[model samples]
Target chain A: MTRGSVVAAGTGLVLGLLALGPALAPGFTLAYDMVFVPHPVFDRETFGLAGMLPRHVPSDAVVTTLAQVAPADLVQKTILLAILVIACASAAALVPSERLTARLAGGVVYAWNPFVAERLLLGQWALLLGYAALPWVVRAAARGEPRRLVLALVPAAIGGFAAMAVSGLVVLVIGLHRPRPAGRSVGVGRSGVKRLPWSLGALLVMSLPWLVPSVARFSGVPADPAGVAAFAARADTPFGALGSLLLLGGGWNAETVPPGYGAAVTAVPWLCVVLLALVAYACRGRAAGTGGLGVAALAGLVLASLGAVMPGLLRWAIGLWPGFAVLRDGQQYVAPLAVVVAVGAGLVVDRVAGRRPELAALALLVPVALLPGLAWGAGGRLAAVRYPADWSRARAVVTAEPGDVLVLPWEAYRTYAWNGGRRVLDPLPRLLPGRVILNDAVRVGTGGRRDLRMAVEDPRARALDPLVRSGAPLTGALRARGVRYVAVDAPEEFAAWAGRLPGAERVVAGPDLVLYRIPGATRSRETPISQWPIAIAWFTTFAALVWSIRLPVGSLFALSSKEP
Target chain B: MRIAVAMLAGIVLALLTSFGVVRVITTSQQDPVVKPLYNYGTR
Candidate 1:
C-alpha cells in the first residue's frame, strides 16, 4: 500500500479514537473542571448575578437537573469529530496518495492527542483550532489564495472563540497577520510582501471588536509578566525540568497519576523532543521560504508548548523573550504545554509518514506515547488536598446546601455554576463584597518574608481569609452579613492549624470539602439558572463544529488546486 | 501570500469573536462587576 493510504487510515483511526473515547467514558467533565466543580459558578444559574454582585456574591442562577450529554463546548470534542469527519471525507474524496496520507497524518495525530483534548477540556479550543489550521494558514499564505482563505475565516472565528470566556490572550496570538507581498503572488521573491496590506486590512476589520477591548484594557490591566518572572528567576521548571516533561506518576507525594491523566512517562513528550531535534536538524538542511517556515512553525509550537515551564532558561528567557507569562502557582500553565506536546507529536507523525515510506505501521505508535500522560488529572490522589466529607460528626459546619454561601479554597464550585448555570460565593474578596472569585494560589496584597512563609506552609492559614482570620471569625463576619453557610476546603488539620477559634464548628466533613452555617440567618430562595448564556454557548458549539470541518475540507481543496 | 495573511487575520478574528464578540454582547448592558461566562459547549 502507498504511504498515502496508511497516513489517511491511521489518522482516521486516531481521530476516531479521540472523537469516540469521551462518548463512551463515564460522564465527567475534564480534570480542570473537576478542580473547579465546587464553585457556586457551576451549580447556580442566574444571569446578572455574578456580574452585578461582588466575588462574595452568592449565585442566584437556576439549575437544570439534566445535562446535555452530547458534549459541552466547541473545543476538543467537537473539533475532534469535525476533524475526523472532514479529513476522512477530504482524503477519500479528493486528496490522493502522498497528499492524502501526509495531510491526514497531520490532522489526526497532531490534532487529536490526549494533551490536545485537555486544552479543549479547559476551553482553549480557539487556540487549538487556530493552531490546527496553522498548516493551512501557512499553505494559503504560500499559495496566495484569497478565496479559499476567506472561506476559511468563518470557521476560524466561530470555532476558535467558542473555546472560552476569558479567552483574551490566545486571541492576541491568533490576530497576528504575517505580511506577505501582493506583487510576488505566485513566486518567491523579495517584493512578495505587497499582498500583505490587503490581508492585514481584512484582518484588522475582523479583529476590531476584540482588539478594542484588549487594547483598552491593556494599558490599565496589570501586565501578566508571570512567564517573564519565571524565566527571569530561573525558576521556570525548578521542580525538575525534564522530569515534568515525562513525569506521569506523582505530585506533592507519591500520588499516583490516574491513567490517561498526565502520568510519569507519557510517550508524547519524548516524541516531541525527538521531533524538535529533527526540526532543528532539518533547519540546517533547508534555507528561507517554506523550508524555513516548517522549521519556524515547529519552533513556535515548541516555545508555546514550553511556555514558562520549560525551566533553566527562565532568567535569560525573561530578559530576551517577551512571549511567556508566569502564572500564579505557576503549574496551571501546563495546558499550553499539553497542546505543544500533541502538536509536536503530530509533526513527528506527519514527518515520519511523509518522509519515510517504510514506517507507516510504526506511525500508529503516537497515541501509545500520549495516554499515560493523562495521569496528572488523577492528581496522584495527592491533589486531594481539600476537605473530607463526613456528616456523622456534629459541630457547626458549612456544607454546600442550596442557598448557602460557598467559601472554599477550590474552583470546583465555579465550574458547576459557570457551565451549568449556578451561583457560588467568592472565595477571595480583595476589593469585592462577594464570597470568592477563585480560591487557592491567589495573591495576598500584603506580603513579606514571614507572610510568604506562612502563606506557603499553612494550609489553614492559606485557606483562611486574611481579613477574617479563621473559620470562627469568618462565620462571625458572615453572620453579620446575614450569610448562613461557610465552606472550608482547607487540609484536614485545619482546625488544629488555626490554633482553635470560636463561633464556627465543623458539621459536615468530606474527603474533598466542608460546609459551615450561621445559626439565625434567613435562607433566601435561589434564583433559577438565570445567569446561563444558554443560546450563546450552544450557538458557539454549533458554529465551532461547522468550522472545524470546513478547515480540512478547504485545505484539501487548496491542495488539489495546487496539483499539476 | 496575501490570502494567507487574510486567513491568519480571519483566524485571529474568529478567535476574537469566539471570545470578544461574546464578551461584547454579554457585557454591553451588564454591570461591570459581573462576569458573563459563555459556556460555548465543551470543544
Candidate 2:
C-alpha cells in the first residue's frame, strides 16, 4: 500500500480507538487540570490572551480561538483527537519501509503507548501534542527540504514551547549526524554547518511565543526542589526507571496509572526492549537513520532516568538554573524514546512479515493486549461532566461587581458535585468573569519543614490563610489589597465565617455557592513588567504565524505551477 | 505541491474526525451540573 494510504488508515484506527470511550460516555472529562468549564477566552478580566502569553501562549490561543466558535467541551475533545491522529500519522510517515503493516505497527506503538496514555490521564494535552509532533519534526529535518522544514514547525508551534524544544533537539541530533561530505574531513563539514543554522533558526522563530515570555520570567522566582522531585520519574529504582522508559510508565503520581493495571503489563515493554535491541543490531550499518533513532532513544532513556541513577547531577543542574525545573518531571523526556521504540517495533514487524507475512498479524496484538486499560479511557478516568448553573449566576454577580474576586476554600483542586465527583482544577477561574486571586500555594517539604503558602511567583493571590482562619474584619486590611468580593464554594461554616467579617455583606447565597461583597474594595492593576512581556510575545507570535503560513502557501503555488 | 496538499488534507481530516468524535461523545450523555462537595487540593 502507498505511504499516504497507510498513514490514513493508521490515523483512522487511532482516532477510532481514542474516541471510543469519550463517545460512549461524554460530557467533559474532568481529569487533572483539564477542567472543561466553558468561558470566554478573550475575557480581559479572566483568560485574556495577554495573561496566557508567557506559559501556554500557543495552546491558549488555539483554545481561545476555538472557544469563540465552538463549545469548550467540543473544542477540548477535538484537540485531543487531533493530537492522537497527528501523532500516529507522523510516526507512520517516519518509518522508512513502504509496507503498510510496518507503518501501521509504528503508528500504533507511537500514538498509543504508555506515555501518551499516562499524559492523557494526567491531562497534559499540550505536552502530548508536542510528543505527537516529534516524529514529523525528525522526518522534516532528515529530508532537509526547505518547504518540509517550514511546514514541520506548524505542528511543533501548536504543541507549544516544550514540543519545539524536543523537536529542536531531534533536529540538532540529526544535523550533527549528517553524513560528512564525500571527501571532507571527519568534522561536521560545510553542508552540516549550513543546515544547522537554518534548522535552529526555524525553531527559534516558531518558538518566539513562549521563548520571549520564558526569558522574561526566567529569574522571577526560584523553583521548589521538593516539588520538582515529587514529579520526578521514580520507577521503584534505576533499573525500574529503564523498565518504565520501555513501558512509557514513569508518571510521578501513581493515580495517573490506569485502574486494574498489574505487573504482567511489564512484559509488554520487556518484549519491546528485546525487539528494539534486535532491530538496532540488525540495522547497525545498513540504515543510518535507524541507527541514529536508536541512539536518540537511548539518550531519551538516560535523560528520563534523571536523578534515578545519578541523583546529585540533576540536583546540581537544577541549582545552577532553576528554569530546568521544567525538566524536573523527567518522565516527559520518554516521549522521543517512545517514537524510536514504535518505529523499531514496526521495523521488527516488517522483517518478520517479510519472512512469514501471516505472523505479522500477531505482532499487532502485543501493544493492544498490554495496554488494555488505556484503550478504555485510562480505566474510566476520562469520564465527562457539566458545570453547575450556580457557577454562571456567581459569574454574573462577579462580572457586575467591578473588582478582583477571590475564590474561597483557597485550594487548587476540588471534587465538585458539578463535575461528577472527579477532582479538577478549581472551576472558579473559569466561572468568574473578572480577575481572580486563587490561593495556588506550592506545598513543599514534609512535616516540620513543610511550607504551604501562596506561590511567590504571583504576588496578586494574597495569602488569605490568616484572614480566612481568623474571620478577620474584611474592610481595612483585605479591602486595601484590592479584594472586592470573596466567593466561597465550600461548606456553610466557611461562608458563615466570611459573612460575619466586618463590612462583608452576603450576596447571592445559594446551596452550592455563596458570595460576600466588600463594598469599598478596588481592583489591582498588573505591573508593566508583567503585562509588557505578554504584549510583545503576542505581537511576535502573530507576526511569525502570518509569515510562516504565507511563505508555505506561496511556495506551494510556485511549486504547483512549476510542476505543470 | 503534493506534500503540502497531503499535509493540509491530513490536518483537515484530523480536525473533522475530532469534531465528529466530540459530538458523539458529548451527545451520548446528559450534561450534569458539576458542584464538588469536597476540596481536594492539588495532588
Candidate 3:
C-alpha cells in the first residue's frame, strides 16, 4: 500500500474508534432502525417475498448469512466500523492531490460530519453503507469499466432501495458526462455512447433483490402519502432548512442531531467550513475531474430541500406513483453532497498548504473540531446492550410452531428497559422463525396539537388498525386474521390487552417479552409472492460480485492499485 | 519576522484547539432528554 493510503486508513480507524467508543463493547447497539439480533432467521421476509415492500430485504439476508459465520453483534460492529473506514479511505483516494494533508482533509470531513452523525444516530447504517460506497462508485464510473462499476455498487445494493437509488443517481449523472480525452471527439466512440447504458443496466440488475418483490407485491406494500410531510427534512440548525441542508444538518429527526450541533457557537464555524469548501469547489472542482458531480450534489441538495420547501409537490408525486414515496426522507440524498464537500475541503487544503501549512493542518482538524458530539458514540447515546433471555425463549416457542406471530402494543418501535430504553424497531420480526406481523405506521412530531401519525404501510397492519383502535375483544378478530401467536414486548401493554385474549393460552411469561397462543386459529399460508425472482436477483448479483473479484481484496481499494 | 509569524500561528492554533476541546467536553455531559415516544424521532 502507498504511504498516503496507510495514513488515510489510520485516520479512518482513529475517527471510527472515537465515534463508536461505547458501541464497540460486548453486546448489540440497539438504537432506532439499527436492530441487530443474536441470530436473525432467514424467513420468506428475508427475500421480500412476505407481501410487504421488503425495505430491509437483502440487508437482513446478508446479515443473516454473515451471522452464520460470526456472531451478529460482531458482524454489526464490523460493518459499522467498516462504513467509517471504507468511507474515509474512499474519500481520501478521490482527492485530486497527492499530499497527505489534502487526503486527510477529504477523509476526515467525509467520515466525520453532520450527515454521518445524524444518519448514524438515526441508525440508518445500511444507508450509510451505500454512502461509503459512493466515492468508489464515482471513481469506477469515471474509469468506464463495467465490472468495476458493478463491484462498486455491491455495497449500495446490499443497502436496499434508498441506497441504490442515491448511488444510481450519482452513477447516471457522472457516467453521462465522461471527460473527453485531449484530441478525441466529445460525443464519439465507445467512451461516450455505450458506457452509461451499461452502468444503468448494472444498477438495475443489482437492484433486483428488492425491485422484483416491490414490483410483484405492489398493492400489499403501500407508501403513505402522509409520510411525505412526516418524513420531510426539517431545520436542525438555527439556519433554516436550506442553510441546514447546505451544511448537511437537516435530518427529519431532531433527536438524531449530534450534541450541541445546532447551537450557534459550533454551527457557525461548521457553516464556514462548508461554505469554504463550496467556494473551493466552485473555483476548481471540474479541473480536478469531479465533472458533473457538482451538478449531482446540487440536485441532491435541491431534492433534500424540497421536503421542507415544497412538501405538497412531493406528496402529489407520491400520490401519482407510490414509488415516488422514496423521496420523503430527502436528507438521505445528501450523500453525494457530503462527498462534494469532502472533495472541496481537500481542494482547499491542497491549494493553500505550500504557503500556509498551519492553516492546512487546521483544515484537517476542522470537521472533527466543529462536530465534536460525533465522538464517543454520539455523546454516549449509543451504548451496547443485550436482549433479555426471555426474548429468546419467546422466539423458541414461536419458532417451534411455524405460524404467524403478531407483535403488539400496536406500534412498530419500542423502548425496552433491557435495551437501556433506546427506541428500536421490534426485533421479533427477524428473530422469530415464521412470518411475524408488526405495525409499520410511524408516529412523528412532538405530541402537541399537530402531531403527525403516518398511515400504515403493511396491508395486514392496516387491517388490524381499526380492530386495535376499537379496544374490543381482539382474540376472535386476530384468529380470523390467522394470527396464531401474539408477542407483546411491553409489560404495560400486555397488562391492558392480556385480559381481552379470551381463548388464547399464555405460553411464555417474560422478563422482557410475552408470548400467547391462540388455540384453534387456522395457519396463514405464506404470501403468494414468489421468492424465485428475488432469489434469481440475489444469485445474479452474487455471481457478478464473484466475477468481479479479480484484484486482491486489499489492492482493490488501494489508490495506487492498477485496473487489471 | 519569520519566528514572530510562526509564534502567532501557534497561538491561534492552540486557541482553536482549546475552544474545540471545551465545547466537546461541555456538550458531552448533556444527555439526550427527549421523550420516549419521540425516540422514533420528531420532525
Candidate 4:
C-alpha cells in the first residue's frame, strides 16, 4: 500500500478505537437494533420464512454463519471496527491528491462526523457498513468496471435491502453524470438502454436475498403512513431542520444526538465548519475530479431534507406505493453529503498549505475538535454488557423443546436492568431455537402522547394481540396457535402476565425472566411458506459474489505471466 | 493592519473551538437515559 493509504487506514483504526471506547471490551454491545447473542439460531425467521417483513434477512444469516467460526461478541466487535477503518480508508483514497495531509483530512472528516456519530449511537451498524462501502462503489462505478463495482458492493449486499437501496440511490445519481467523450453520446439512448452498463443489474442481483422475500409478501403488507411523520428528520442543532440536515445532524431521534450537540456555543462552530467545507467543495471540487460526487451529495442532501420540508408529499407517495416507504427515514440519505464534506475538508487543507502552511495543522484537527463527543464510545453510551443468567436459562429451556416461543409485555424492544437500562431489540428471536414471535407494532412519541403505528407483519403476532391485551387466560388460545413457550422479560408485569397462563407449567422462573411451558400444545397444522425461493435467491447472490472474486485474481495472474 | 486582523481572527476562532470542545466533552458524558417503559421507536 502507498504511504497515504497506510496513514488513512491508521487514522480510521485510531478513530474507531476512540469511538467504540468500552464497547470494544469483552461483552456484547446491546443498543437499539444491535443485538448479538452467544449462539444465534439459523431458523426459518433467519431466511425470512416467518410472516413479518424480512428487515434483518441476510444480515442475521451472515452473522449466524460467522458466529459458527468465532464467538458472537468477537464477531460483532470486528465488524464494527472494520466499518470505521474501511469507511475512512476508502473515502481518503477518493481524494485526488498525493499529499498525506490532504488524504488524512478527508479520512478524519469522513469517519468522524455527525452522520456517523448519530447512526452509531442509534445502533444501525449494518447501514453504517453500507455507508463505508459508498466511496469504493463510486470509485468502481467511475471506472465502469463491473467486477470491481460488484466486489465493492459486497458489504451493502450483506447489510440487507436498506443498505442496498441507499447505495443504489448514489450509484444512480453518479451514473447519470458519466461524461460522453468523442460526441458518441454515452448517455441514455433513444431505445431507453442505459449507457452505464451492469450497475443496475448487479444491484438487483445483490438485493435478491431481501428483495425476493419482501416482494413475495409485498401486496399483503401495507406500510404504516404514520411512520413518515414518526421518522421524519428533526433538528439537533440551533439551525432548524434543513440547516441541521445540511450539517448532517437532523436524524429523527432526538435522544441519539451526541452530548451537548444542540447547545448554541458548540453548534455554531460546527456550523462554521460545515459552511467552510461546502465553500471549499463549490470552489475546488470540479478541478479536483469530485464533480460527480458533488452532484450526488447535493441530490442526497435534498432527499435527506425532503421529509422535513414536505412530510405530506412523502406520506402521499407511500400511500400510492408501499415501496416508497423506504424514503421514510430521510436522515439515512445524508451519507453521500458526509462524503462530500470530508473530501471538501481535504481540499481546504490542500489549498491552505500553499500559503500559511501551519494553518493546515489546525484544519486537520478541526473536525475532531468540533465534535469530541464521538470519541470514547459516544461518551460511554455504548459500553458492552453481558446477557443475564436468567435469559440464558430461558433460551435453553425454549430451545430444548424446539417449538414456537412468544415474547411478552407484547413489546418488540426491552430494557434489562443489567444492560445499563439501554433499550435494545429483544435477542430472544435469535437466541432461541424456534420461530420466536414478538410485537412488530412500534410505539412512537414521548411523554403522555403515544402513537402506535400498527405494522402487524407477523400473522401470529396479529392473532395474539387481542388476547394479550384482554389480560385473560390465553392457555387455550396459545395451545390452538401452537405456541409452546411464552417468554416474559418484564419484571413489573410478571405476576399479572404469569397469572394469565393458568394451566401452563412454570418451566423456568426467575426475577428477570419467566418461561411457561404449555403442555399439549401441538405444532400448528398451517403449512409454512416454501423456503425454496428464498434459498435459491440466497444461493444466486452468493454464487455471483464468488464469481466476482475471480476477476481480480485472474488479472493478477495475467500480469505476472506477462512480467515473466 | 493585515497581520493584526489575522491575529484577531485566529484568537476568536481558537476561543470558539475551545468552547465547543469543552461542550462536546460535557455532553458526551451525559446519557439521554430512557425510561423502563419507554416508547420503542423513540430514543
C-alpha RMSD between model 2 and the true structure: 7.1
Instruction: Estimate the overall C-alpha local distance difference test score of candidate 3.
Output: 0.79
Candidate 1 vs candidate 2: the TM-score winner is: 2
How does model 1 score by TM-score?
Answer: 0.49
Query: Candidate 4 chain A, which ten residues in sequence have the lowest lDDT sum?
Result: A555-564
User: Candidates ranked by lDDT, best first?
Assistant: 3, 4, 2, 1
Give i-RMS (Å) per prediction.
16.9, 9.4, 5.3, 6.2
User: Distance from true position, residue A546, model 3, in Å?
Assistant: 2.0
lDDT of 4 by residue, A195-312 (tens): 2557677787888999998877777776677888788898888889888998888998776787657678778987887788789877765544433667778788888877889988
Overall lDDT per candidate, in order of appearance: 0.33, 0.59, 0.79, 0.76
Per-residue lDDT of A205 in model 2 = 72
Sorting all predicted structures by DockQ, with the top scorer first, yields 3, 4, 2, 1
Q: Write the residue-wise lDDT of candidate 1 on A1-564 in tens digits.
A: 334434454545444443344332332222232221222233221222221111111111111111123222222333444544443333232221233433443344444444344443333334344444433433343334433333443334333222111122222232232324432223232122543443344333333323332332232232333323222111112234334432211121111122333433444464455456345334321211222233333333334335335544543553443222322222222322333333333344445655663353344333433442322221121121221223122122232243345355432223222113311222222211233323333221111221111111112223334544433445455555555655554444346423332466555656534555566666533323332343344344344435445545434333322222
What digit string (tens of lDDT, one per residue) describes model 3 on residues A40-116?
87778788877346889679889999999999999999999989988898888877776677877888899999999
Candidate whose DockQ is highest: 3
Cα lDDT, model 3, residue A452? 77
* Per-candidate clashes, comma-separated: 119, 11, 0, 1
Candidate 3 stretches greater than 4 Å from native: A178-190, A551-556, A560-564, B1-33, B36-39
Task: State which candidate, 1 or 3, has the greater lDDT.
Answer: 3
Instruction: Tell me the DockQ of each model, to 2 decimals.
Output: 0.02, 0.09, 0.21, 0.18
Ranked candidates, highest TM-score first: 3, 4, 2, 1
Q: How many backbone clashes does candidate 4 have?
A: 1
Candidate 1: clashing residue pairs, number: 119
